[model samples]
Target: MSEPNRFLALFDQVVDQTIAFAELVDRAGYAAVPVDTPALFLGTRVDKIAIGALVRHLLLAEAHWFEQVRDVSPGGVIPFPSNAAALEGIPDGAPLLETYRRSYAERRSQLEALTEADLTKEIVFAGRRYTVIGFLWTVLGHHSFHLGQIDLLMRQQGIEPPEYMEWPEDQRVLG
Candidate 1:
């Protein structure tokens, strides 16, 4: 019921939803599509990178966001490299899954160590200061936004998203 515990609970819910979304994406099956094709976005398609790459970027970005919150370096950015020959640097299939797993582990560990007092403290990143609680909420929102996009993409590909996935349950009590 304390502030920090509440924040941690919210964080856990967000991560659970993210994992569900990822599982849905995995079940949808990645098909060979041209990298230049439009990606699914809220029932519409927009010119963007392939779905696989987008998923990879989402996973990497989530990890990076967590790293920033924990005041650690996330190493190199994982966006698509411009050089066609550089694709080899990104492991395909299973290795990509491994990277995500490792990042999740680190994030969870950091989350476990957070205290309520920590939530109110301001942290500076890239010259911008944000309360720990605010940063955590931002990461959650980012993941939810991307998951919405993934759902649309799956529908476009004629794949049905998992039926069990739903919006994160609201825990607030109404007076």
Candidate 2:
């Protein structure tokens, strides 16, 4: 495969892993980890936020970053509620997963139109500059970090999160 095709394939892998993991969590039932259930997030500061809030934050952050990279002015602020009371509007389970799917479909379509040269173009955001590919890598890494957090939340409730690290045969690019 060409370099551009190879790079784009990684995005597909990330999306597949995210959707697969979310499906596992959904099948386990949102009741398994109640929206208001406090879960510890090991960030710079230890936060015990509601699991639903964290899930909502992840979905919004992913979509926001994707939109930023696509040069689309976002419509509203990204939600990152500090407490359950602030997250009353956030939906969990299949509805949240469906929202992610829709966002990914839109972002993926934008990505498909970019050439390899476009990936190297620099863009400024929040007073910092980053190449298109660099921003994309950051987005994928953010997904990885949050996926682990979600997995921990699932395990805490005796729910088995989807296996993300496994190299599925279908994704293998055979020579």
Candidate 1 lDDT by residue in tens digits, 1-175 = 7655565566565555545555555532543343333333322112244445555655666666665555532232223223333233655455555666676778777876766566666765545566877767766676667666666666766667665334366556311
Best by lDDT: 2
Worst 10 residues of 2 by lDDT: 73-82
TM-score (all chains, Cα) for each model? 0.61, 0.68
Query: Which pairs of residues collide in model 1?
Result: none
Evaluate model 2: give its TM-score: 0.68
* Candidate 1 residue spans exceeding 4 A from truth: 7-49, 72-94, 124-129, 164-175
Residue-wise C-alpha lDDT for candidate 2, range 26-125, written one tens digit per residue: 5445434344434444442234443454466666666666665666322323222233243355467677667767777887788778766667777765
- How high is the lDDT of residue 16 in model 2? 65
The true-versus-predicted C-alpha distance at residue 168 of model 1, in Å, is 11
